[model samples]
Target chain A: MTNEEIRDFIQTAIAENRVMLFMKGTPEQPACGFSMRTSAALNALGVQYAALDILPDPRIRQELSAISNWPTIPQLFVDGELVGGCDIVTEMYESGELAQRVGVEQPQHEPEPPTAEAPQSAPLGVENRLS
Target chain B: MPTATELKERIESALPGSEANVEDLTGGGDHFRAEIVSDRFAGLSRIEQHRLVYDVFGTEIGGPIHALSLKTTTPEGQR
Candidate 1:
């Protein structure tokens, strides 16, 4: 597909979906470390969302980079809007804003896994059905 | 792929009367940041103004250039 076409498709998907994440891999199988981390953060927030893999089509990744002006993959879109990349998501998670944005009741805070108990959850906001 | 100069030119040429300071933030040949000023942004929402800058790059945004961190303001807003 043309770059503009891809960009439009992605933008529309986001606009129509309430919560979405465009990542390198699926929530069940994150292809990149960044995506993995974001998955973890989303899980911590306890929200359902969709993760679109940009790996199959290099163009999707390229088009997304152009549309968001963000270099990295694993972008988070909340309520059909671009939230930042992993870093931004992590920051928002730390601030508990990520949970708030997605309409999930805040789970009690827990330290990141392999350190302290990270509450009861898996990584990723992979409620792909929602988006 | 667009060279830094070409991207700069596209941004400046497309944005008439916008005084922008565009730079290659990464020096890796893709990422950029622009501090753009214009009177057109007086009442526009932040998202609208950002979208205006995004419009400049069009489809070339993600391919050759990777990032664009923007700070936008009107001549009066800058004060």
Candidate 2:
């Protein structure tokens, strides 16, 4: 598809889905760690979301990065606005901001917060660390 | 692939007076984690701050640099 067509496709998808994730794979079988963590955060919140796999077409990612100006996959959209990727989503999930943004009631249980102060530069667990 | 030091230098140079700490998360010279503190970030939202850093790499991002987990803040925001 041409860049214009891809842009249109992305715009339509965002408008059509209230909570959407442009990820590497489906929520059930995410291809990347960031995708997995973002999907997992949405699942943990029990919020319904639409997942589109970008692996089918390289143009999907190309167009997405161009339009979003965000050089990452696993991009989440809520109420038609870009929320963020795994790190931001995971942080929001921990802070209860995601639920608020999604307009969903928080689940009865919450995940435990980090217990120890980590090294400032340690890769956040949600990020990909594959060599 | 750009080394973590190279990426760090790029960021620090692009945002003058910024402090950048970059680490290769996987030692692969691809996936990286960057912690940046800059006075330039004072009024920007987290997203905007991140975008500034990202723009420095432009196409290198999502290409040679497969991932860059960013932690950006103003000096005042840093702990």
On TM-score, the candidate that comes out on top is 2
Q: Considering summed lDDT, which 10 consecutive residues are worst modelled in model 1 chain A?
A: A111-120
Model 1 lDDT per residue over A1-131, tens place: 57777788788768866777888776667776667778777766666666678877788877777777655567777776677776557656766677787877766645443111242454334333222
For lDDT, the strongest prediction is: 2
DockQ value of candidate 2: 0.52
**DockQ for the candidate 1 complex?**
0.10
Q: What share of the reference contacts survives in each candidate?
A: 0.06, 0.44
Every model's DockQ? 0.10, 0.52
Stretch of 10 with least lDDT, candidate 2 chain A: A122-131
Error of 2 at A3 (Å): 4.4
| Model 1, runs deviating above 4 Å | A113-131, B1-79
Interface RMSD of each: 4.7, 1.0
Per-residue accuracy of model 2 over B1-79 as CA lDDT, tens digit each: 7898999899999999999999999999999999999999888766687789889998888889999998887889841
